[model samples]
Structures are given as structure tokens and as C-alpha cells.
Target chain A: MTTNFSRFEGTEDYIVSEDLRNSVNVAVALSKPLLLKGEPGTGKTLLAQSIAKALGLQLIIWNIKSTTKAQDGLYVYDTVQRLYDTQFGNKDVSDIKQYIKLGKLGEAFTSEQQVVLLIDEIDKADLEFPNDLLWELDVMNFHIPETSETITAKNRPIVIITSNAEKELPDPFLRRCIFHYISFPEADMMEQIIKVHYPDLENTLLNEALKAFYWIRSQHNLHKKPSTSELLDWVQALSAGGISPDHIYQELPFLGTLLKKNQDFDTILRRVHNRGTGENQQTGTRIFRNW
Target chain B: MFINFFYLLKREGVPVSITEWMTLMEALSKGMAASSLTSFYYLARAILVKSETNFDKYDLAFSKYFQGIETPAQISDQVLNWLENSLPPLDMNIDLEERLKYQLENLDLNELKKTFEERLKEQKAEHHGGSKWVGTGGTSPFGHSGYHPGGIRVGGASLRRSAVKVAGERKYYEFRGDETLGVRQFEVALRKLRQFTTRLEGPKDLLDLDTTISETCNNAGKLKLVWTRPSKNSVKVILLMDSGGSMGPYYRLCNQLFTAVNKTTQFKSMEIYYFHNCVYDQLYLTPTCRQSESIKTEEFLRTHNSDHKLIFVGDATMAPSELTEVNGIIDWGMTNDEPGLTWLERLAHHFPHNVWLNPVAETYWESSSSYTIQLIKKVFPMFELTVDGLEQAVKKLKVRQ
Candidate 1:
């Protein structure tokens, strides 16, 4: 199937399905608190940012942490520092008026125009974090108890929150947004990404590097597989080092750029040496990864 | 390089506060090395400036503000080393005294007993005179709330659990929901089911039926619409899940596939049964889920939609006799599949809509012990019960129709 992924800029041009593009555009339109879950590094947040760029809107992102809290995601009200200022910073309590410093989420709400608010890696945060925002998100507003004023969105920015599916999130939170799960990019699409990112690289070398990437992913049973971005990184790395795919079997560490887990490393190492084989012989040259 | 990035920003006049510096410092401590410069920029940006507004502010502020602090790309390594050399050291200490002394361990008798007593003493819990007497009200020190259903919110889902357990004992159990790997994958695949949901208007395939799409004209934004038809097939189904203990590892996958089926497939009403170790033609819905068919197995297969898709969500790894029942549903009377897994083969034969999806990788099908799994393989392709596998099965069904 052909794709209109050209509508998206700043990357290797590739064909993407109308369905997926529709999904991406819908994600951009709803820009209203959408939740996206997919495998690690499948470009969930990248897709969010791309949508923002595609729409000519400012992009605000919050790469979530394990310890992330609801209020913490919004502007942090340095209460302790403010208390200290009242008690010490030369400004008296009356002079030291409590002002809400805008955090990522808070900033997104205050933007004068439509924006894309991307909460990357939502799974790393506590599940309640998503549920916590259900009310604020539905309303696109938050209140400051200290100032007793409510901060609402100027333009309801398309909200694209991504999750790695590390754990299950509440259904109520998921139901709030349209959902899409991306699989590994098709090989041809992956190749296009590489070609876009590294222009001077030779087709043969790129294919070999891609072969190694494809072989490593299909060969290993690792928890973390290489993503499209990682694949691009791997291609660049190989090209920069003048590493050829034929020589890749001799250099497993280069594969490390694409894979993270030790078991994955071990699996690649074994495959490079030709251990557990599949009947679908390593085509040395295979082509796929369409829209 | 990213480690030193803020230093560049600092020299440049962008006032990346100490807190932003600390976020970089913190990420560095967790092993976000400077060598990975690609993600390094994004991480630092997220820590220092989250929005595009901040991006311009910092960029513009740096040019005039620094006056002359040297290019960021050039001095990144030096600044990174400096940042790395500085920053608080993380202390990763571990002490598992309580865990090391629990009864779950094969500890000596006195060591176990002493820990138990100490545990009870710590909680101030004591049995009333060893056991409570009928007339005398020997009160429980660890009272009221202990055994009550106190709802504890977990992963945003509240679970009502009994309170009487020890704090340590009441640990996080793997909250395995009805969601399984197969089902999770299936749900995603079936998302394309919206394409199939449209009514068959004429002799054309799926796309022709739903030709009603509205495209708005205006420079506002790209017009978007959701598919409006519901795709549901009303065929009755009989599914059996292999609750084989060995298959437990793949259970979630099994459940996910079926869950997707339950949503996308237009089965009139689906009834599922679970069988462990062996299939007696009986199915269960839970661990406590059991269904002993009073009506003969042959009778049940004959009744209802003879067109029913006999879907078996299992890893065909049982003995052969129950399957090779040339005479009946199962020969449980004779040693359960002494010759081979004949019972499994028969299960496949019984269901024309029968499709066997095994969560086990397709390559391992060769090593299975039962001849039945191998024989049934010919009747129903033994697939790696996965999201892709379910999709393939669905496609195969469509082709057959």
C-alpha cells in the first residue's frame, strides 16, 4: 500500500498507511488528551511530536518518571522554597505572593494557540497519574489552591500520551482517548528511515546493516528490541565506522547500538555464528516494512 | 555531551536553573551517558526546557547573553567530564534481614518459630488462650479491620482483600487480569476490524460497503471521522482453553487472543471450557471453572449452529487416546492416551470450524510428545498462538469461507 507520510517532515521519507496516517492525524486533531500504548521505542512520543509539527503547533512534552505525580506533572509549587522566602528571602509573606510556576502540563494549558502536549512513557509513572488527570483533562483546566485561581487551556492542545505497556493502566483512563499500538516498522520503511537520516551511505552497506538489524530482532528473545530510531542510530554508527554487514557477524558490539538486553546480545552473538537456524534462510537480502 | 550541554547553556546566557542542572545530574547518575548524544539532547531538553516556547527563549537568550562562551558542539565533552566529576554519589545499599528469615525459606525449626513469634509480638497479635472458648469472649488483639474486606487501590484498580494478613505477607501478587498476551495482541489486530464491520451492501468486498465519508472544506484542520458500522458475526461457538500447568507461562497470550476474538468475532454466544493435563471433552471457565457435559460430546457438537467455529485455544500437548477415539469422544476408560495423544486429534476432527492456536513457538511443534498434536496439526495448522497467529487464523477462515 502507498502512503502520504511525506506530509510529515524532518525524517527519512517513507510510505505510511492511510489508516495509520489517519490514526496519527486523528491523534493530532484530538490533541485533546489521547493515550497511546505500544512496544518500547516504537516511536510513540516521536509520533506525538510529529503530529504537533505537522499541525504547525508548539509541542510540549513531559517524559514521565517512575516517581512522577499528578501535581508534579503540572507546575510544581515550590511550597518549601516559598515558605523559606516568606521566612527568609527578604520578602515578607504579603510581598511574597504565591505564584504557580508553570510545569510541562501547566505550560501546555497556558499556551496562546493550539499545541501538542506529549506525555512520553506514561507507563513509567504511577497508573493513578493518568486517572488523576481524567477530570483536569476532560475539563482542560486546573486550580491553584495557593492563589485560588483556576488555570485552563487557551486552545485545547491535542494531547498524545504514550505508554510502553509495562503495566496495565485503568480502563477509564484509556477510554478517554483513541488508542493505537504500533508494531516494529516494516523493513522498507525502516530502510527509508535510514536513507533519510544518512544520505551519503551506500545502498549495499545500508542493506547489510539492515539485514543485521532484522536478523538480530528475529533471532533474539530479548526484553528490549531495537526501535526505528535505534535502527537509524545503528545505520549511522555502522556508516561512520565503515562497518560492513559482511563484517557485522564478526562485530557483535555494533549490534549493541540496536539492542539493549544481554540475552538479546547473546542471541545476536549466536546468530552471527549461525546457531539456531530457521528454514526461511537469512535472505541476506529481504525487503518488507511498508505502511 | 548532553551532560555538558547545560554548561554550554549557562555560558550562553540561558539561565538553566540549578534544578534543571540537577535533573541532568540525576539522569547522568542513573547511567544516561554522554556518549549517547542523540537521546542526550532530548533528555536535557526535557529536563531544562519542556516546551517549544522555552526552546526559542533559551536559544535567543544564549546568543546575546553568553556574549562569547564557545560553541556547544565543540566543548560538550569537556563540560560533560566536569559535570560527571561533580554531582552527588548515589548510595545503593541492600538489607533483607526480614526476607532472609521467613518460613518460606527452608530455615531450621527454631529459627522459623522464633521469627514467627517475633513477627506476632511486633504486630501485638496474640491468640486468646491458644484457641477461643465458646462462652468466654477471648478478644482478638489484632481486631476488627484484619479480616474485613478493606478495598486497597492497586494500579488504579481497587481490589477488596482480607485485612488479617501480615504487612509483609500482604505483598504485591502478580495482578494477572483476564488480559493475556494473545488477547492484547488480538485487540490491536482487530482494531482493523472496523474495516470489516460495514454491511455487505452488494457483491463487492469490505471497502465498497462503507462509501459514506464526509470531507469538509476549509483551512481549519484535516477532517477526521470514525467508522460507523459494528462488525459482529452471530455464530455460536465452543472453545476449550488448555489450562495445562506447563502452558501457564503462555496463558496470558492464550487469553488475549480469545479476548480479541470475543470482541471482533460475531459469534452468537461464546461458551468456553478449561481442561488441564488432559481434555475429557469437559471444559471449565475458572480455576474453579469446570463443566462436565451431561449431554454426550457428540450430541453437543451436532446441536446448534453446525456451522459453529470450533475454536480450541490450547497448546495441543496432551496424550493421544482421548483423540484417536474412533468409537467415541474419549477413551478415558483405557489408560488416558497410552498409545499416543489420539484424544487431541479427535478434538480437531470434531470441530470443522476448529482452529488450534498454540502460544508455543511454531518451531517447537516438532518436539511435542503426543502424536495427537502432530496429527491434529494436519487438520488445524499448529500456529504460534500470538497476535500475528490469530490474524493469520482469521485470514485462513476468511479464505475457507
Candidate 2:
């Protein structure tokens, strides 16, 4: 295989460093369980999707919820619909049996196609949520009750399970995964991301916004603030309407692209009010003594 | 003597206020006895400490404020021996017998076993006839993973005629629906999953399965497979999961993407320790979680390994001191220790092969983003999590050997 990520479907170039790339490739090729733990947004789920696309495998996703049961990942029995069918439509009684749809795990079991099972956001699931999977992934087969059949994977789907380190998983569960990382980007790359997001941004304004962003980052006090997506929005707002720093200061928190917390807005207001950091100002050089 | 570990949090320059600390304390005292070590550790933290990027600052303050809190009571030799050597008197909360009863009532393992064995027996008998497999009215004992009541798959419904014919002949044989009527049932039961049950045996059991399959795969010339744990989740996976701050124009999107990533399971298994203003020694957990991290990192890494990957999710544009020492990140004289950039050095030394991925574009790898690129160049490879980033990581791990 070429191993060029673009060759994979649904995956744009997931530009990671050399170690992470190799880890991802090894992860994709094998049926061995992959345990990826890192900071949030380090591209864990995307790796799974990338693998599924790279191989011509079915991408079977199970978005784990907090209330997810051990049985939730394996196979689901829709009792309500099944019982409903049983009471109303059972002319031959066997018709009632036909209506019980299998959940994600059951579907994975019965399907003949090679697939990639993306257990996305697995950490949010309860502690024991992973226990059931150890067996199924280990055996690559599960016994199907509806048919009294054991639908073993002729060739199992590549299992890519993701967790966000919300809490420590059990030791047994942790021991099962092959580890790797996806760290945040460096400054140059982020600037490129900015350029990509706001193609028409003037160099001066772009530089000013970029500098301001880095400066505010050094501020020790603030509630939850802007992320990469929010930065893109701020740039777009400025570039699109020629909205200067003035518009950003006045129209923000309402701009939908700027920030979430009142603290983030307050931070911006403090900068603008003190240092005169707005569009059309000379140099827009925020002269903060403390920041 | 209990104190808000949040005071320790300030050493790391975390902006955690008194309000968040009160909320954390309320959540703490509200709980019954501290059943979980990790929970109690966090509860005390919520009351005092606050730092973002510096793990070291938090640890220093935590020890100063809450030292010896986790240690159980010191017991004499005879009492300790008795507690260790013999079972304790039965108590409603802590008794072994009650625990067993709790397991049995909730799990119903026997019933589950019965269902499993009966299903196996039916399979072995090759009896996919229209007769009911287990219970009343020829219904399927099998749930979603079950066959039709007539033991037919809906797709196999075409072959139902043959099954019906077979059933007509054998309804007399398998249909002892009334268990009280003495039909010759197998005296044997299905083998228990205790073979596969991880707790029933030990980690050695894991090896046995490996070897057993190892033989078969070897005979077939197929590769043998084994499963194991990551080197790090138990080790500090200090997450610089980018929250929106002024790092650069790309800060907002990066934050959301990180947030979505935080909402996942795989990320949670590792010690999802976080940092904010410039990566440093004294880092904070949440606005409420004020505990600091300063275990002997060198001692930790002697065991943890350089392969332990350090993932920095911030834009990395600030002065390097914010990432290296305490004074740089506004570490307010909590200690003489350098708080900001020194932390990164320790991390780099510990996990020499760490990486930094900017969510920003590739073009910005120039003067504007010098600090980020500069930091990334140190102990590990630096790249974006774009196609190129994946390529670079592949290159590094391959050559690591």
C-alpha cells in the first residue's frame, strides 16, 4: 500500500510528526487493539476514520454515551419495537422475530464485510464499558442469539477505539491498548491554519490578530477561552466585512465566531480599551506592560 | 487540618478563584466517606490549588498542603498481621459474603450459563427445526443474537420448508418443553468463561491464551498476536489541549476540535492532566481541580521511558519561559524553582520523543511562529496534525529503533 494518507478516503492530510505517523500506520494494518490516549483534539477518532478509508473497509461507528452498558457495544435488542410488532403483526408469530433489529455490535458481528469499528469517545462510557470488548476483539467473533449463530469475523474489522483521558480507565483496560500521540500544532502551522481560514486577510491585520492571540494566551487569568475554530471565526469576521479591531471589540460575544465565556470577551475588552488595539490604528501594536 | 489545595494551585499561576474552590469543596463534603483515592485526591485539590501548564508547582503545593492525607492509619505488628492473615468479622458494608451475594444477585451468572449451554446443545444437535428451542410456544430463547422461534434466520427463510419438514419428523424428539417430564438431559454443563475471565486467573492467564493460539498460528505459519498496555496513560499524559486563548488567529477552531476530542473515551484513559498559560511545571487540572503534580519526574521517567509521548496541543507562540519556568508564567514566589520552561525541559528529557502539532496552517512555520517552531525542534519532532504531520510521525517512529 502507498501509505499516503490522501489515498485514504474521508481523510484529509492528518499531518502528524514522524512517530505518530508510523504508529498510525501500524495501528491501521493490524487487528491488534489500539489504545490511543492524549490531550483532547489530538485526532484520535480521525485516525480511525482515516484507517477505514485507507482500507476499503466498512466504517462502523458506535458513539458511546455515559449510560452505555457493557451490552451496548456488543448487540442491542430493540424490545419496544419487537414487542410492538409481537402484539400487532404476528400472524405467524415468526414475523415478530424478524423485527428485532440488532444494535451496532450485533450488526458488526453479522456483517460479512471487512470493517473498521470506531468506538468513538469511549472514555465517556462507564468504567466497565471496555470489559465486554476485550473478549470480542480478542476472539474476533461473537455468538449471535437471534439465529443461534456465532458470527465470527472471517476477517475482522480494524477496531479503533478512542478515549479522551477524562478519567483513568481500569488497569486491565489500559493494558489492552497500543499507545501513541497527537500533540497540538506549533505556531507556524497555526498561522497557516489562519491563512487557510481567512484567505483574504491583509498581512498587517493578520499579523496584528496573530500577535494579539498569542499575547492573550499568556494572560494567566480567564475562564474558558477561544480555540482554533474560534480564531478562524474572528479572522473571517475581520477579513470579510473589513471589520477592524473596533468591530471585534464591540460586536463580539455576539459574533458567534469569537468566544464562549464572558471572561474571554472581557479579556478582549481589556486589551482593546487599554492599548487601543483596533483596526485602522497605527501598527495595532498592543503595548501591554504586564502581558 | 484540611485545607483548600487551591492555594497550591496559585503557585502554578492558575487563575482559579475562590468561587470555584467553594463549589469544589461543596461537591467534596457532600460525598459519603472518600471511597475512591482518585476522587479524594481531586476533592482536596478543588479546595485550594490552581495552575495550568506547570505540573511541578501543583505537586510542590499539594505536598506542602495535603501531605500524609492519603496514608492509611499506622497499625501495630500483631493487629496488622491479623488483618493481613485472617478475614475480618462480617460487616454489612465490608463483608466478603455480602459482596459475593451482591455479585450473584446482580449478575445471575448461573442463569446466563444455562442459556449459553442450552444454545450450544441445540447447535450441536444440528436441530434447526421449527420446534421451539427453549421455552413456551416454540419461541426463541435467543434474543437479538438468536434465531427465529422456529430456529430459522429470516434470510434462511427460503430453506424453512426443509426445516419444517425436518421439524415435523422430530417434534417428538426435542420438544420436551416441560422440564419436569424426565427427558435425558446432558449431565454436563457448558465450560465456564472462567477460562477467559481475567480476574479468575491473573496476567499469566493472558500468556496462556497467547501461547495456546501461538501454537495454532505457528502450525499454520500465521502470526501470533498478544495484547498489552500503553507505557503512558498511568504516566502523566499532560495534555496541552488548546482552550481558546490568544495564541494566533487559529485559536478558536483548535479549541473546539480539542474540546470534541476531550469528549471522547480513548483520550480519558491516560492521566488527562491539562495546562493553560504556556506549558510549565505548575499546571492546574480544572477551574475547580486545584491539585498540582510534582512526583519525582526523573524517578518517574527512569521507569516511564522516553517513548512516553508528550502531546502539546497549544499554538506554542508565547515566550519560552512560560513553558520553561515559574517566574515566566507569573509563578508568584511559591518556590525558588523555575516554573515555566524548566517544566518542558524535564518533560523532554523524560520523554525525548514528544511532538507538537499546530492546528494552524503550514505557511505560518516562519518568523511569526518562531517560538512554537523553536520549542518543537528541541527534544522531539514538530508538525501539524495535517497530512504532513501524520507522515512525519510515521517517519520518526520507524527510525526510533
Q: What is each candidate's DockQ, to 2 decimals?
A: 0.01, 0.01
**What do the candidate models score in CA lDDT, each in turn?**
0.52, 0.48
Clashes of 2: 121
lDDT of 2 by residue, A1-291 (tens): 223322333344444443445444434433445666655545677677767766667888889889787676666555445434544655444643454556676677677887778788887776556776777777777765775766577666667777776544554454344444344555566777666545666876666666666655545554644555667767776676665654443334333455567766666666555565454423343432222
Q: What lDDT, from 0 to 1, does candidate 1 have? A: 0.52
Worst 10 residues of 1 chain A by lDDT: A1-10
Give one digit per residue, the lDDT tens place, for model 1 in B1-401: 34454666666344466644664565555444334432343334444542222344444333323222222212223222322222121122233224323422553434433433343335332222111111111111112211112211111111123221221121212221223343334655544322233353334322222232332124132332223434444445566776655676775566566655555433446777666544544444554333342333445556644455665667666545445544333323424322224445555555555667777677777774656567667767656677677677655544232
Question: To one decimal, what is the Cα RMSD in angstroms of model 1 from the true structure?
Answer: 30.0
TM-score of chain A of each: 0.82, 0.73
Candidate 1, residue B69: the lDDT equals 21
Model 1 Cα displacement at A95 (Å)? 5.8
Regions of candidate 2 where Cα sits further than 4 Å from its true position? A1-14, A38-43, A54-57, A80-91, A95-99, A194-206, A244-256, A271-291, B1-401
Best by lDDT: 1
